[model samples]
Structure formats: C-alpha cells, structure tokens
Target: MADDSLFAQGMATRRAVLGDAHVDNATARTTEFDADFQTFITEGAWGSVWSRPGLSKRERSLVTLALLAGLGHEEEFAMHVRATLNTGATPADIKEALLHVAVYAGVPAANSAFKIAKQELAKRQEAAQ
Candidate 1:
C-alpha cells in the first residue's frame, strides 16, 4: 500500500489500540522535531506490521509485551499493558508472556515488567470500579 494509505490505516489502528484520548494527547504534544518520528511509527509499526493479518491483535499484544519487557522498556511496557484492554489480551496472557520474558529476557527484566504490569492493571481495574 502507499504511504498515505499506510498512514491512514496506522492512525486508525493506533487509535483503536491506544484510544482517542491517548492519541489526541500525543498529537497535541507533537513537536516539529518528533513529528516525523510519530509518522514513522504510525506508518511503519502500526500500518506495515500491525495492519498485517498474520496474527490477531491479542497475539501481537502478547508479543509486544514480551519484547518490551525483554528490552526493559518499562514505560512503553506499562502503556502496552494498558493497551491490552483494547487488544483483548487478558491478564493470563500477559502472565504467560512475562514468564517467557523471565526465561529468555532474564529474571530482572521480567521482575520489573511484572511490577509495572501489576500497577497498570490495578489502575485500570480501579478506574473500572
């Protein structure tokens, strides 16, 4: 698909996964320097990869969580943990993925990821209540 089409598709997917509020907040904070970076992630990551039909969003979410946890991207991991609500990734799925992280990514990474995930999940649950 063309870049424009990819960007459009990516924006839609991003919104669906991250929600309008988060997207809008990011958009609002976009600066001249980071504008291209934002577009790159939208077109490349969300459009080209996420838009693919090979895996369900739930599966993608799990993979993303594991990768982020493995890389020790605590903030992004927490954000994706919250995005699981829209991605249909359950707490069980997240636990399994974190277990994989522990085995492959190291106990320290998984330990930190687990802590962040618990905090984010608790915030979501509290909000729902």
Candidate 2:
C-alpha cells in the first residue's frame, strides 16, 4: 500500500515547488486511466526521490528539465520550463542546458526544447510585473 504520510509530504512539496495552481490544474486534468500513474508520480517521484536529502530542489529541477528536454518530452519540457522560475533557475541556465542537450541528445530535440522554453519564458515574464 502507498504510504499516506509520504504521499501527503510529497503533495505538500510538489505544491510548494510546482505551485498550487499548477498542481491543482494537473490534478483536475487527471483522468481515471491515469489516476494510478499520477499517484505513482506523487508518491514515487515527488515523495521518494524529491524528498531525499541528496540534492537540492534546484539541482533536481535542473536535472529534470534537462532529461525532459533530452528525451523529447515537449509537454513535460514546457511544464518544467515554467517550473524552473520557482526553483531559482534563470532563463540563461535553461538556455545553457538546452545547448548541452543539443550536443549530447541531438540538435532537433534541443531545437524543439528551446522553442518551447522561449515561448514559456515569454509567457512567464509577461505574467510577472
């Protein structure tokens, strides 16, 4: 059985990092088919690894963003691009990571990720004062 305390802790941390509104919208968008997957991510990814003391949230965010971009997960890449703002990762850092992705992952993947990041960054900047 999933640990309720762990799940709760993960949910709290997830909200803090990802923001309540984003998490709420994600939760609201979850369907029955993906319910288990969502729980696994909450309890496993967030509760387990993210709660560990090994890495700062900022480091984890950087790794996660790079992996998403490298893997060509555009949707997740966009979400994490916005998430970097809260994790203290500047747009320059993200651009640098995408450049690295271009070298290691593939130019096409990096290009797509950069496009998504640019758009997301623009939206985020506009939302700010």
Candidate 3:
C-alpha cells in the first residue's frame, strides 16, 4: 500500500505545481491500465523525491524540464515548461536550460524542446492577457 502521508503530500505538491485543472484532467483520464502507474508516480516521484527539502521548486523544475527534453519526452517537457512559471522560473531560465541540453543531451532534443516551450509560453501569455 502507498504511504498515506506521502501520498497526500505528493497530491498537494502535484496540484500546486501542475494546477488543479491539469491535475483534475489527468486524474479523470486515468485508466485501469495506468492507475497503478499513476499511484506509483504520486507516491514515489512527487512524495518521495519532489517533496524533499534538498532542492527549491524552481531548481527542480529546471532539472525536470531538461531531463524530459533530453529523453525526448515532449509531452512531459511541455507540461513542465508550463509548470516552471508557477515555480518562479522565467522563460529565459528555461531557454538557458535548454541551451545546456543542446550541449549535453543533443541539439535535436533541445531544438524540439525550444519549439514546444515557445508554443506553451505563448499560450500562457495569451491566457494571462
């Protein structure tokens, strides 16, 4: 069984970072096939790691975005790019992180990530204004 306290903590942090609308949609879309996977991520990723005190949310956001990009996880990269705004990471910081990905991860991955970031950032700007 999942740790209740850790699960609660993870859910709270996930909602805060990803936003209620996004999290709600994600939860709603969870299927029987992936339910266990979702639970594991919440209990392990969000609760065990992301909730730790070692890194600031902003730092974690940067690392997450870069790692997702490096792995060619475009959907996750886009989601995190949006989440970065909530974590106090600026567009410039994201761009810089992606630049680092270009050198370390590969230019193709960074290039794709930049496109997704630009699109997501533009959407956010439009929503705000």
Candidate 3 Cα lDDT to native: 0.93
Report how far residue 70 has shifted in candidate 2, in Å: 0.7
In order, the Cα lDDT scores of the candidates are 0.94, 0.88, 0.93
Collision pairs in model 3: none
lDDT of 3 at 31: 100
Q: Residue pairs in steric clash, candidate 2?
A: none
How much lDDT does candidate 1 score?
0.94
- lDDT (tens digit, per residue) of candidate 1 on 1-129: 348999999999999888899999999999989999999999999998988999999999999999999999998999999999999999999999999999999999999999999999999999999
lDDT by residue for model 2 (5-69), tens: 88898898788778999999989999989988888999998898888889988888888888999
Taking all chains together, the TM-score of candidate 3 against the true structure is 0.96
Which is the leading candidate under TM-score?
A: 1
Evaluation by lDDT, superior candidate among 1 and 2: 1
Per-candidate TM-score against the hidden true structure: 0.97, 0.92, 0.96
Which candidate, 1 or 2, would have the higher TM-score against the true structure? 1
At residue 25, what lDDT does model 2 achieve?
97
What is the alpha-carbon lDDT for the whole of candidate 2?
Answer: 0.88
